[model samples]
Target: MKLQGKTAIITGAAKGIGAATARLFAFEGARLLLLDKDEANGAAVAASIAERGGKAVFRRCDVGCEADVRAALDTVVDVYGDLDIVVNNAGWQLNKSLLETTAEEFNAVLNTNLTSMFLFTKGAAELFIARKKGGAIVNVCSTFAVVGSPGYAAYHASKGGVASFTRAAAISLMPHNIRVNAVGPGTTDTPGLHDGARDTGDEDQGMKSFLALQPLGRFGKPEEIASVIAFLAGDEAGFVTGALWMADGGYTIV
Candidate 1:
């Protein structure tokens, strides 16, 4: 019940880490707002939360769109009266070489993964400042932000941007008591990952490659990552800001 009575918004909440975070936040007593482009699954997650006795609502949003981000937060404040936490968890990945990545593809990936963070942060910070009540923003980053790989040029760039932007945003918003931080997760078992693998046309190989990178010899669970996010959002992390909390299972150590 660390987040009892708090209001939270989680983008890309239809499934995977976003879904797990929604469930966990609900259990902790936070009023939930789940956002995703997938209309069906997003609504389903909200319905599931209600069944579990948590207050939740779902909104279909393209996080990369400013209008959508604004509207989503507006709806949250309208329904819940205020906003306390926001988790920028929506993202897209591109497993392509730099030479093969088209300009449009790169732009789209950046818009989805990096620019979306900008939109959410700006939108939520405005509300937080106006309310005169500081809020928390937990960004979902990746170990790829720190590590280098052959393919996924755009994804690496976007994630790296997120890592740096999180710190800059944290410093800029400190005066308002609005905290910004990031969680860098290693490869996790999520629908998104599976989908990404399918997109690559080699699901098993993609998974094997990911597993090989983890010293733990296994993938991470959405619930495990969600726990970290919950801690950062709650009062326990009041003093922590501008930090990159890595939930990577020793992925960056080597």
Candidate 2:
């Protein structure tokens, strides 16, 4: 129960890595606020946690919108009375080359993938500062942030910004006793991947290509990523801050 009594608000908690993290955090004794744009799925996830004797609430929120983000965070604090952790796990991707990517597409990815992090961090940090209690923030970045992908120029750029912002936020929040860090996961098996494949109109081939690039011979599981997130958010990582922990299965090593 590393996070016993802690309150967490996780964006993108409807499915995949976000959902996995929510489950893990509940297991570790944290009260949760699960945020996602998908109301049905997000509510289902929250119900699942509640059925397992965990405390959780679901909110329909589009992290890309500052008003929505602020409202959700405010609601969590109202219900839980305090917010100690935030996981900016909401993201979007466009598998288009630089030449094919339009400004609108780039902005869309940037809004969800990067800007959301900033908005949540700013909102949460203010609360933490006012309470004079430090908090933890874990941004979900990508291995692509460190390495280039063929058709992910905008995605790469957004995640790279997340990495840099994590570091900067860590330093800026240190005085408030807040810790900010990031997790970079490699090709994880998720709904997002399926969507990416569908976008290319060759699901099998896209998946196969992704698998071939993983030296581990397989894609990572969402739970695997969640475990790392739990670690970083807990006291076990008390001394860790401004670090980008890569959970990619040697994708960047080769």
Candidate 3:
């Protein structure tokens, strides 16, 4: 019950790590708003939470859209009177190298991975300040933010931006008692990972290639990453801010 009685907003919450985080937060006794472009699954996650006696409301939103983000913030306030934590977990990935990546594709990746995070962090800080209440913001970065690979140039850039931005935002919001932090998850066994494998032009082979590089000899779990996010968003991490907490199963160490 670390987050008991708190209200939260989790982006990209229709599936993968986002969906898992939402569920964990609910179990910790937090009311939340789940945002995702997938209307059906997003609503279903919320419904499932409700069935479990947890307060979760789903909103269909493109995190990259300013209007949609604004509407989402408004919806959270309307549905739950207060906002205590915000997890900017929405993201998209591209497997192309810099030479093969298109300008449009890069922009799209940044909009989803970096720009959306900026919006939610800014909006959430504003709400916290206006209410004179300090809050927590946990951003979802990636191990690729610190490491390099042959492909996924755009994704790497976006995640790197997320990490740096998290630090900069943390400093700016410190005086306001707002804590900003990020989680760098390793390769996880989520639909997104399989999609990335498909982008490699061979799903099975791509997965096998990925597994060959795992320091842990297996893929990470969405729920495991969600636990790291929950720690950052909870009061237990009060003294933590401006940090890139790694849950990468030793990915960066090697």
Query: For model 3, how does the per-residue alpha-carbon lDDT over 1-254 read when each residue is reduced to its tens digit?
Result: 98999999999999999999999999999999999999999999999999999999998999999999999999988888799999999998987899999999999999999999999999989999998989999999999999888888999999999999999999999999999999999999999999988878899999999999999999999999999999999989999999999998898998
lDDT of each: 0.94, 0.94, 0.95
CA lDDT of 66 in candidate 1? 87
In candidate 1, how many Å is residue 157 off? Answer: 0.5
All-Cα superposition RMSD per candidate: 0.8, 0.7, 0.7
- Candidate 2: tens digits of C-alpha lDDT, residues 1-254: 87899999999999999999999999999999999999999999999999999999999999999999989988987899999999999997898999999999999999999999999999999999998989999999999889986798899999999999999999999999999999999999999988887888899988997888889999999999999999998888999999999999998888
Give the local distance difference test score of model 2: 0.94
CA lDDT of 162 in candidate 3? 99
| Per-residue C-alpha lDDT of model 1 across residues 1-254, encoded as one tens digit per residue | 89997999999999999999999999999998999999999999999999989999999999999899889988998999989999999997888989999999999999999999999998899999999989999999999999998889999999999999999999999999999999999999999889777876899997887788789999999999999999999889999999999998998997
The superposed Cα distance between candidate 3 and the true structure at residue 68, in angstroms, equals: 0.4
> lDDT: which candidate is best?
3
Candidate 1 lands at a TM-score of 0.98
